[model samples]
Target chain A: MIDFAKDVRLWFAPSRLKDEGDTPDYRFSLANERTFLAWIRTALALVGGGFAVDQFLPDLRWGVRVGMAFALLAVGAACALRAVNHWVRCERAMRRHEDLPLSRFPVVLSLGVGLVAVAMVVVVLLGWTSGR
Target chain B: MSGPGTDRDAGLQPERTRLAWRRTTLASSVVAVLALRQALRGSGSSTEVAGAAVIVLIWLVFLWVAHRRIRALATGRPPGLAPRSALAVVGCTVALAVFAMAVIL
Candidate 1:
């Protein structure tokens, strides 16, 4: 019987990775890919969220759409940037003896996204109050 | 073990980051289209499209940077890429929030 772990090792050429990290290489790579997928999912969620915003307020105006589009676009770009950084950090930590560089990832971007979301709320309020 | 002379850019990062940025651009484009469709059908589509276009341009810059990184990686000398811009993030959030509010009310 083929050993699944051994087969995977051969397929991925795991030998390319350094052997001393606290985390396993295979697990690390998988985690990196999963992180990328999460970013993609987040991008989709923002898109959907942007779409849904219109449903709640039919009295919509141009400003809200413009703002929301920009916000969602920012969030999407951040997600992709996070994906790239995660891989870079993870790989560097595993492959190079050098210390892993500091990362700002979701830490910095998520907060920015949250604020954008708040802007979304503000826009709703402004539109409703203006009575346009 | 990574052999001697393996710089940071010696691996697949450029390709990976490029792909990541590409995905981001694609998603932004989709959202832009969605916003424009909604706005045009109603009264706010043009604004949404414009805002989204602005965001896309940002991603395009990101894409170019990623490509440069990829080439650096391919050459086996890691290049230092700047961290994500906080100002850009804040601006985008503010823009999106405003757009959403406009549409909802």
Candidate 2:
């Protein structure tokens, strides 16, 4: 595990970063920053979806309602955390002239979202049958 | 390639990044508004009022951070984002999401 004290220091201090590597091209860094922002927006949208599900779907069974909301909320939180971690890692990679780190996060995220969509369809059909 | 001003022109990368920051700032603002609406929508008790106030405060902090980054990107040769500032932005976002969950639950 990463040293918690060191992680805290890195979060609060700028001195350690200057020694990480050479500065990368401005355009690449800008692109990385934009990517981070995009992920953040994605997280926000997911969280908003969670709120919508909880607030607007009072007709939904309580178990389904809370479950879906929590699922979205949890993914949103994960995305927010990943956004910054990825940004930092990318920045470091660029500075060091190394290959950008790759992860299965995008694939997992897509699958997770697809599963949620499928769940929503089932819930909607169930609600239709019960309401009528 | 030939002239001094040509290199700095560089095809609008900074401009695009600045616009992205602006877009995110607006998006976060909408989220904060939604969270605040949720908090105060019904018979808002004192606790709800306090939560709403905190939501606004966190949103303002995010706005401030984004505004700084946006302004920085307006320059032709913008410096890299400070680590602390990046941490602040992420912290605000995570905090906002947590508060949103709290409001819901």
Candidate 3:
């Protein structure tokens, strides 16, 4: 049986191992790091939004409110996980003098946020009709 | 290892990277505090409180690691570039998500 815990630990191992590849231009590495940080900030914003919705928003149908909050929280968690993966992949690509990997996170993030926004709008409309 | 000649752009690159790291740490700390406050005020449950504490602790550790990396960068040391702390952040975020769901449900 595979030890999932050990696999996870190994997967997140420090990027200093071996240091085999040539160091690319410092600017490229710094840019990649900055991109990683940007993604982390985005994730943090999503998590904060989730908290705000859950804590502060008035009840617009408990199920819908909870669903919206859950979606934001899940997407935020996903963004955080993806940020580290993208950072490591970009660093490795730079070190190896290879093309950087393409990222689909933007698409995922936009779609998730767009869906949540639509849901909130619908809830607001329903509230207006119901006079609540 | 010091090379014979100093590169003109070396200082700026590390400084920029350090700033990015600091910005990320600040953002994560803000989220952690928000989570803590929401947990304390929304539910007041022991599990939620514990989860928020763990999240804050992880963010603190991340800040410490980032500070050390910034110092190393300033001194011309190669950054370790580890994602271990970043993963910890993600793990804590997942825990926070669970807490949020619990409160919502």
Cα RMSD of all models vs. native, in order, equals 13.5, 2.7, 4.4
**TM value for model 3:** 0.79
lDDT of 1 at A16: 36
What ranges in model 1 sit over 4 Å off? Answer: A1-24, A51-58, A97-100, A126-132, B1-105
lDDT of 2 by residue, A23-117 (tens): 88888988898898899899888888887888777787777887888898889888988887778778877878999988789999999999999
Q: Return the TM-score for candidate 1, rounded to 2 decimals.
A: 0.43
Model 2: pairs clashing at backbone N, Cα or C within 3 Å = none
List residue ranges in candidate 3 displaced over 4 A: A1-10, A15-20, A128-132, B1-11, B42-52, B77-80
CA displacement after TM-score superposition, residue A17 of candidate 2 (Å): 1.9
Among the candidates, what TM-score does chain A have in each? Answer: 0.60, 0.88, 0.83
With candidate 1 superimposed using the best TM-score fit, by how many Å does residue A28's alpha carbon deviate from the native?
A: 1.7
Candidate 1 interface RMS: 10.1
Selected candidate, larger lDDT, 2 vs 3: 2
Can you give the TM-score per candidate against the true fold?
0.43, 0.90, 0.79
Give lDDT tens digits, candidate 3, residues B14-77: 7777888788778777777777777677456778668667767766776777787777667453
Q: Which 10-residue window in model 3 chain A sums to the lowest lDDT? A: A1-10
